[model samples]
Target: MQKDKRYDQLLDRIENDRDELVELCLKLGNTPSYHAKERNVGDLVVEWFKASGIAASLQFITDESVNAVATVPGSGDGTSLILNAHMDTGPEPGPDATEADKKIDTAWTEGELIFGRGVINDKAQLCAFMIAARAIKRAGIRLRGDLTITAVAFETGAPSIDKDQGVNYPGEGFGTKWVVDRGVTADYALVGETSGFGIVRAECGAVWLKVRVKGREVYTPRLERGSSIQENPNAFAKAAHAILALEEWAVQYQKKEKLEFEGGAIVPKAQIMNVRGNDEISQASPFCDIYMDIRLVPGRKPEAVKKDVERVVRGLGFDYEISAFQYSRGHIAQNAGPLIAAIEEAHRYVFETEPPLPPSAEVSMWRDLNVFNEVGIPSICYGPPRQRDPYSGAGNRAMKISDLVAATKVYALTALLVCGVSDR
Candidate 1:
């Protein structure tokens, strides 16, 4: 974990600019970047890069949102690195906000914790990467390999889960996939998720399935008058039966599909997220849609998970069709990969000890680390451990300012080591 003087200087710079970093986190959290609507925060990210003299631009994925991409070019002799962080956050406090939600949703530093949605979930990491970039620039250190940062969009929500919502809304990985499709790749990628400063070498991927039940549509009055309930065939009620069957299947499937790896482990899960039937309350609905969220362990295929669901639903004697609406295969990287090694070195230097690695159950949360690892560019997640909302039991919902600074140091040092420093 011995770092060059340049790397040490950069860490010092990050420490000196702690107030500016906090401001960036607050600014991003205050700006509402809900789901795919990330224009405000994305644009601000791009502006920060430009103002810092870094090469910056917008990778437009949709009419409304763009990925904020910036780079510190290198001399082309060493390995390149990518620092990826999502621009979006989870749901915000609404009109009926609890006192805790109101307090934590707004980013601020009181003692050690920085209470906010964006800072806790991801935007804090985004700011950390930005500070790392600034520290490098301030030290006037040139890298032999390139370093790129992306503030991506559409991470908070899934893509195209509901047909009624239209296919135009391409869901999760929208931003990161766009970056890859546009050929913005590197030798490795570092995802700044809430990994608790530990290296996350594996994470579960998700498969979203939509099941539709079909039957005859009839008026309730006719069924009440002479027809039997079976003749009227309420698809909604039949879907209810399928849900109960799915619950039973979930218990068995999760146990059967459980997997453990050296980097982490996962208990593949199936949960019914939504059920939709009649548009009008008075009408007898002939169709019902069941939406399921299935988390897949690494090496598990979406087709297999779909088949499992089909088996349970078909066994219910209901006329139904099931399809995987969305699937993201989980990703796993070796603990000895360059990405993990650099992160470990930096983490040890920052904390003066080896970082803790989470167990399988603890590291099962999904992030874009899978995106890079799936493409053969080794990647891992390393960042601050998320704080829980004491009142709401919300996980990955808060952050400590000190932890944020520590992560910033790790990010900067890792980039220096992996990218290699040069005199230009």
Candidate 2:
């Protein structure tokens, strides 16, 4: 009964602080922390943490990028927990961005929902972590173990490709890896991402490959026709054949690499992101580059996957070179039972139902969970769902305010359970 009373106090405190949590979410969602440029948002997070009396600091990964780390120290008797979320939003709008695209950075409220780019994808959960700690502090709950909240930069899956300039775009767990390597660890980690309030134990890793196909360069007006696409002298013609082959291979690959776990299934997928070639109109290109993004299930080796890709592309009878510019292996938590039990209990206390598994699509994508599990810290991804438009079948870059409050309660309760309360 005393434990139940403590849970009530924490939930009440979180409910009373809903307005402040919403304000923080809006503030964070309004800030444009585009990938690789998250300094401003990071500073805001630091200020909020300090004002709330939590000890906080920034781990600078680059001159313009930093990971915000905040903590509520415990008395060193129970296990520690890390609640992590990315500070950076999705990619910025390009030159031809629509008005809707431009509106992604601006936060707005309608009825019970908050609309913005980062609001649902991450900013909401980031704010929830901060508010959960504050609620614990306000409820006079002295934890026996530490509760650390991290807002890392560069959790976006974009690779660090150096083209015209230097390596300007550094992503794919860059900040999370840095903080982990620098000793910001815990007994377990809960990554706050868009998981539809379900628990995700496994996630697929990814590899970005650049497949270059070589051909003879010739003037467009003087180019000779060939009997088949493979015999054509132009790289673009041969690339068509390769693309078809890849399309066929991708269907089979997804079926062969599907992985199933207790939580859900991970269907590894592949796609040709872009095809690059010469832009000069008067000449046939000498070479074409196909950039591919391939997702791999846990225990799958990247080198083996690359070899499989090479075999498929080489069979097109074209001279080619394939190289993986970026790769990270997928992982499953080896000892996540304790953490899962804590979350499940907290979730049931908050929602009065059993927690469900996230959709297969959510588990198939990459997130910072992979980073924590890679360093031997058992981790899982959990957060609220994104509101979907019924008619348009499009996901709104928004989050429900009620969902935010519920997630905050669950996070605080989970922390209380995982990091046992102290008498002091």
Candidate 3:
């Protein structure tokens, strides 16, 4: 209704302004901050917001690389609405090593797609939101709620997952929780995660596991006599047994997810395995550690899975212990909330369809969304989406000309409606 009209109105503007958005993404992506470099990517996002007439600022969390922040302010609803993206990307951009540091590095571009480190992971999302903020300011529509955009760091690290430990919450860590503590209260939080035009209602939680296998060493002459090492304490053999057992348990866990959940597809179609990594054996040093990431289903708890993991290692009858453990609380905010409905209405207005629905199955990797969700925020993740264009497997990183135009229409319409523009 209201959303459709808004999209119809904003479609042209979204198309007109995409190149600017892509340029912003490239310049900033080149910043070493893509990983955890000294420079802060948040700095660039903040600059874009303020430069475009939005009230943007940085809230310092610390003096170190982890202590940075970025925000863009909006008008309306007295209550603030959040548009957030983590400032960090895993395996951050490597040294540019050359000057062609252009936003769409031709050297990095492949066919229709733009290429570069950190180009897709998140810099794209940040750019999309920045462009949206700029468009709203240029158009003069007032919002029902104030729009606040935040870009921060260290989302790829472990401490970043604890929502209860939000920034400056009198705790010692960085995460979405920290963003909340630093005054990012909003009616809803939108994670710009490149999920095409849909929302991610359920975020799969993660549990980190490290299994250690120690073996006894014996000389070949005495291998037969070593009680623990009839075959020199066959650590490899023990590891294989443990891995096989864990695989069996993981399968059962996955099956449980299929029967227990709805919506999204359980992809890669199974749990990830780091069954046995970094193994070593010598006459002097004999031990192997199997490190793995366990992405639990929305309703599943790592604690519940912990016992299963323990049972498997124990069932092997080999000595083992759970070395380190951490888990993310799963989350799903009713997509029908006034906030989401309005946003989706805006999306439908732009896309001319119901817009992609949220995924039902949890994603396999961990993300900052866990922090907001764990602490009870109706958090969901989304991002501009484009498969490899017809020309190739990639396209624009920030605003796929095709997807960006569509997303920009959605963003503009959603912003206008959510911000409370009285008429189209």
Candidate of highest lDDT: 2
What ranking of all candidate models by lDDT puts the best one first?
2, 1, 3
Best by TM-score: 2
**Candidate 3 local lDDT, residue 418:** 56
Give per-residue lDDT, candidate 3, residue 49. Answer: 66
What are the runs in model 2 whose C-alpha is more than 4 Å off? 1-3, 162-167, 279-282, 389-396
Q: After superposition, how far is residue 179 of candidate 1 from its true place, in Å?
A: 1.0
Expressed as tens digits, the lDDT of each residue in 1-424 for candidate 1 is 6656766777888999998989999899888886667888888998999999999999876766778999999999989999999987755458998787676666776677777776676799999999998888888888999999988986766567544365236666667878888999999999888876678888888888989987768877665422442333778777777788898888998888887766655777778988887677877777998999888888888898888789887777768898877778787774337777788888888888988876455467568878887787888888888776563446447688888998999999889889998866
**Runs in model 3 lying further than 4 Å from the true structure:** 2-9, 62-79, 92-111, 158-173, 219-222, 225-232, 259-284, 334-336, 358-365, 386-399, 422-424
Candidate 2 vs candidate 3: the lDDT winner is 2
Per-residue lDDT of model 3, residues 63-180, tens digit only: 5344234334444434445676766654432485334333333213443455553656666676777777777766665565677776766666433222424332321115466678
Error of 1 at 257 (Å): 1.4
Number of the candidate with higher TM-score, 1 or 2: 2
- For candidate 2, lDDT tens digit of each residue in 105-149? 677788887888777768899999999999899788999999999
RMSD of 2: 1.9
Local lDDT at 397 for model 3: 38
Error of 2 at 178 (Å): 0.9
Worst lDDT run of 10 residues, candidate 2, spans 388-397
